[model samples]
Target: MQKVTLYTKLNCHLCQDVYMMLMELTLETPLEIDLVDITHAHNSHIRAKYTDRIPVLARPQSEVELEWPFTMADIRAFLSDPAPDS
Candidate 1:
């Protein structure tokens, strides 16, 4: 299974769209999604970094990230690539 983190914010249509894509992809792919709301005060640093890049999909413990405007094919490609050793 692939473990990933999705950085997002509330009321973001783009984020919602990505979430739906992830959910649909889960049906065929073994994915573990960790939804992180950058809006929370606890995630201030993350919020600052992703304020303009909501709905970013990233591999856990890896720097690889797929930003918004990505398609299902892109997601599949991203997941197909193995995460680099940390």
Candidate 2:
């Protein structure tokens, strides 16, 4: 299974869309999804890191992130390609 982290905030349509896409991907792939709410974090660190770019999908170990406005193809590519150092 791959570790997929989603950095997002409340009332974000793009975040919701990414969540939906992650759910769909779960049905076809083995992904351990971790949803992080930027608002809940202290000092707005997460918010600052991903303020303009909510719904950021990151592979922690690999430090790979897939930003918003991505299609299913983009996700598929991410999944198809394994982490560099899982």
What are the C-alpha RMSDs, in order, of all predicted structures? 1.4, 1.6
TM-score between candidate 1 and the true structure: 0.91
Error of 1 at 12 (Å): 0.6
lDDT for 11 (candidate 1): 96
Identify the runs in model 2 with alpha carbons over 4 angstroms from their true place.
none
Please, what are the lDDT tens digits per residue for candidate 1 over residues 1-86?
78878898889998899889999999997889899999883857898989988789998888899998899899899988876725
**Which pairs of residues collide in candidate 2?**
none
**lDDT over C-alpha atoms for residue 4 of model 1:** 77
TM-score, per-candidate, Cα-based:
0.91, 0.86
Weakest 10 consecutive residues of candidate 2 by summed lDDT: 77-86
Candidate 2's TM-score reads 0.86
lDDT of 1 at 1: 74
* Model 1: colliding residue pairs: none
